[model samples]
Target: MPANLTADFLKARNEFRAAKDRHDKLVALEKMLATIPKHKGTDHMQADIKRRIAKLKEETQGKSSHRKGPQLDHIEREGAGQVVLLGPPNSGKSSLLAALTNAHPEVAEYPYSTVLPLPGMMRFEDVPIQLVDLPPMSAEYSESWLYSLVRHADLCLLTLDGSLQAEELANTVEEIILLLEEHHIRLVRRKEITEEEMRVRDVPCRIVLTRGDLGDLASRVEELSDLFPVIVTSPIDRTGLDALREGVFVALDVIRVYTKLPGKPADMVEPYVLPVGSTALDAVRMVHRDFVDRLKYIRVWGSGRFDGQQVPSTHLLADRDIIEIHLS
Candidate 1:
């Protein structure tokens, strides 16, 4: 059986996932239960929702009975996905984050200007991705948070100084790679395998050539393409800003799926974020587990569809595809 789910249910799920407080989570769960389809297909999902609601209520009561000390935690990931900017000192990482987001990371020409993680939200079309600017990665210096930040990130934007001479750029990048390797991390193209290590973590990364507005720097950095896939940008001139936005979205391997009522149009305002190659059944399950057993089929209204064409539950979905689910 397939899960025939609705967009409203998915939105509530996101709210639950993103909620910072127990009260907010409880509110989101209640909305999720209300939005969930009342059908046999959703029986399991209904139970799961109720279970979560009960758990949250219990936790709320427990919280009122206990007081906790201040706790140190990593920057909470927000938006569609979390991405980090990593590079050597003076690599223009802060400038790039500042340009793309509202975050005021202290941009300076000298090294080690940023002392802590600075996070901001960047938008691609209507989708928001969390971008974090961390202290630079270098042979002599890197914050303790660098490893965890890169490891947990959905993608890493390797910011490089376009103004650096070719040889200097090569050395800087090589050192950065070695530093990552020491921490059991490796950067590679999606298909490339990491050299054997007890706990090697391979991260998907792309190069962002910053300061290209400087004399002939953009062209010089083009010579490094054999080194890695590169996106050139200049915060001063706003060059390649659009390309950077689109590149990050694609590199993250994410897609958005929209849902619709049987006879009404799909809700275009909000979408369910899923990885690429996600199927109709996968989407249904994400919307709510109960949709799994009762989902009869799905009708898609985008990309290769002839307007609301019926598709198998296993049909692969693309970004912006409008899906209408039927029940048994």
Candidate 2:
């Protein structure tokens, strides 16, 4: 027998939620509304979904003056996330990018080979995540634009050469942290609550040990644990590629949702990785204000009690769901 209506609904709902294309969300929303079963089992769900669909359409018609700006462009997920790679000269950022992604950045055994930022997409399970290699900075002084880029990134991957001693490595981390703090981009330890906590706030991060084969890499990672989470990887040894890929996704704060529909085959959609504090309204906003209006009912499938279960618009979403939304 085919999957139940709730299963199909959740699948499509998640697809729409994770959709990068605005129009694709509308299509998914329409399919969800059409395929969901009618009657008491889904009555309230159908009504609310319809209401949202209408609201989304009206909002798109320029009804709300509160929604106007360049921010619309910001409401997008072209890649996993905008992550900038930062560190001093010869920190192995460019080398790591060249190995992880197909970008052939200058990879000489020298300092400052990269004078400008080079962008490349690293695909994890076919989901393309952006990684930008920024120009190297020094502890004594950092360029203004370099600081700005790191500040704006959804996550920053700071590479530390394993060859540096414990004290030097700590100093380098402290310096970069200070630079980040100077620009109001502080890394918080979500695990700890303190006057100056190091939680993964709006922006999450991970330390990558480049040149992992070097003798001191492990020791340095151990020392840095007091500061931030670490991902020990070597583009040369290729020892931690898998872990690094997962780290990129985690730092991006995304979740994957598959799509299933009536009389349709299921497919894996892009990762709908929002920030830590994303809400259903935030998820809807990810699509467009129009869809938020027309959001009727979202039926979910896969994992947990909600698996193959239908819920109202106010329902929260889970990870790796097959969601379908029924709209008006």
Candidate 3:
């Protein structure tokens, strides 16, 4: 018989796959074990999960005693989602990060100034999105762990120097794509994944034309706009920063849902972030997994025919929707 995995189990498994830090991975594994169907078919899987959890616990204890230099291999994700900036040396990754986020990466006139990943929270209206500025991706100073960062990113921003001629900029972009492809990472503009491309990781990407004030980039932007969403930005003049933030949020494809008690006012601040098309059931699960079983129904203030209209658990949510959960 097949293992007959459940939706909750599959969601936990995906979390495990996407987890970079050991603590997050262990939590996901525990959830997987908890949600997986208990049957003869899943006996081996259960045993494997148990063994991995044991090993992780051992490693976690050992790490406290024999900690070495700071490991930059993994960055704990923060805010809504992680967006990694990639490009050749002096492609303005550092400058862009400094301008957009609070991160103070060393922005210099020379190449290879950034040696590690620097992350900062960039607030877009009400949401805080993480922006990580990594070391430049070039033959001269690319880090081996850069591929892992890009592979796990929610969205990748390919920064290109707008001052370079259109042909040179295009060649640089091609080289960057080829280098990532060698590591089994295919950059795509869309979020949809297909079965045939399961072997390679498809990371959604956007093109950022930096140094927009330096040269006439109309033709350059026109050329690359056909392939990817192009955002021409100049950190000096603060041009296109707002548009970039909006674009990044759109690329992440998430919705914010506000929660309210049955008789209380809605908490407008810090809306719970969920992926697009997430249902009322998903929101309840996010609010508290224990509420799933006790969930009676939901009432919606937005995205409903009438205010405070009763909605079923399967009701799809929209951006800025206010939901009040009714539990048994």
lDDT of each: 0.81, 0.68, 0.87
State residue 295's C-alpha deviation in candidate 2, in Å. 3.7
Misplaced by over 4 Å in model 1 are: 1-73, 191-198
Best of the candidates, TM-score: 3
- Give TM-scores for every candidate, taking all chains together and pairing residue i with residue i: 0.75, 0.69, 0.85
Compose the digit string of candidate 1's lDDT tens values, residues 77-123. Answer: 78788888999888899999999998998888788998888899999
Clash counts per candidate, in order, are 6, 37, 0
| Residues 288-307, model 3: lDDT tens digits | 88999998889998899998
Model 2: what TM-score?
0.69
Choose 2 or 3, whichever is better by TM-score.
Answer: 3
Give a tens-digit lDDT track for model 2, residues 1-328. Answer: 2223576876666666555554666677777788777766566556656765776676566676576543321223348677778888888999889888878898878888887778888888857888888888786656666765665566778888877787888898898887777666676533222212112223456777777776557678889878878888788888687898888777666666555554465556554555444445555556457877887755667643745566655555556666665557
Sorting all predicted structures by lDDT, with the top scorer first, yields 3, 1, 2
Q: How many Å off is the CA of 100 in candidate 2?
A: 1.1
Lowest lDDT sum, 10 consecutive residues, model 2, at 191-200
TM-score quality measure for candidate 3: 0.85
Looking at candidate 3, the ten consecutive residues that score lowest on lDDT are 191-200
Q: Once superposed on the true structure, which residue ranges of model 2 sit more than 4 Å away at CA? A: 1-77, 190-202, 269-271, 276-289, 303-306
